[model samples]
Target: MSNTVFCRKYQKELEALPFPPLPGKQGQEIQATVSKPAWEAWQALQTRLINEKHLNMLDPESRAYLMEQMQRFLDNQETDQAEGYVPPTQA
Candidate 1:
């Protein structure tokens, strides 16, 4: 299997905040409890996965896989935001 390197460290300060899930149009609220460092890492990883062309140049299968991964990352962020998880600001 290939290796993955995500440049992010864990931060506890963000975790201690009271992040109550916001109410949505569907009637109920969604809760998310992600640490600041993990959130930053996830965002960076998503950007790398979406912008990096190296994986696409490797092979058709690799390209397809990367695209799928990118889509999932986007969906996850949307869902998380809808559920009320404020993403960490980019540094």
Candidate 2:
């Protein structure tokens, strides 16, 4: 059977990731609280943030910013948005 966690993002119990998605205490926290779907959603947003903001992972500041955003995202808290980002208009 798969592991289940009380996903903070979804506010419900759901399937957990097979392993920690990141390193350190934060990763352990996430592994115990975040679900796979929520993690995947964060991954997509992280990619967009990197691309839209031209963030360099090699820079400590950039990594820190992303980590802060990821924590907020998983906690269902408000997060910073990329400048000039506009949602696509519905067809």
Candidate 3:
């Protein structure tokens, strides 16, 4: 049996992550409220942000920016988009 959560992003009950995606209280909160699908979406977006923006993970500022974006994304708040982003067209 899988754990279920009332996903804030999807606004419905969905499959939960096996563990928190991050460390600390925020990670625990996300583990409790976010769904696996939503977390995966965030991961995709984070990858785009890193690639498109040429973010350096070694830089604390870059990491902070990503963290802020992640929180906003999970909260369904407005988040920064990758520069020169073009949406892939459906085939």
Candidate 4:
């Protein structure tokens, strides 16, 4: 398989992840569509969201919230951002 894919978030061809970021159909879908940079960005955002929101992974509601956010993010839709978190601008 080619090492690149058209990133659904970016709407352009970009480097793909070496493997699925998660398990099951969701992971496979991300692997087929999301790019390395996009996924990495998501990881950072995910971290911020978790930390800022004090999310408990063991809580089903928290996990579900994160899943919903992840779907919105991957779909290039507006996601719930961390309060006071300003993304670093490209210089």
Best by TM-score: 3
Q: What is the alpha-carbon RMSD of candidate 1 to the true structure?
A: 14.9
Judging by lDDT, tell me the better candidate of 3 and 4: 3
Candidate 1, superposed: residue stretches over 4 Å from native: 1-31, 53-91
RMSD (CA, Å), each prediction: 14.9, 2.1, 1.2, 2.3
Model 4: per-residue Cα lDDT over 1-91, one tens digit each: 6599999989999999999999999899999999999999999989999999999999999999999999999898999999988878999
TM-score of each: 0.30, 0.86, 0.91, 0.89
lDDT of each structure?
A: 0.41, 0.92, 0.95, 0.94
Ranking by lDDT: 3, 4, 2, 1
In terms of lDDT, model 3 sits at 0.95
Which scores better on TM-score, 1 or 2? 2
| Model 3 lDDT tens row, 3-73 | 89999999999999999988999899999999999999999999999999999999999999999999999
Error of 2 at 49 (Å): 0.1
lDDT of 3 at 21: 89
Stretches > 4 Å off in candidate 3: none
**Residue-by-residue lDDT tens digits, candidate 2, 1-91:** 8989999999999999899987998788889999999999999889889999999999999999999999899888998877787778999
Model 1: weakest 10-residue lDDT segment is 3-12
Q: Candidate 4, which segments miss by more than 4 Å at Cα? A: 86-91
lDDT of 1 by residue, 1-91 (tens): 3222231132223442134222463112111334434445555664555454345546878656644553445345332112333568999
The order of the candidates by TM-score, greatest first, is: 3, 4, 2, 1
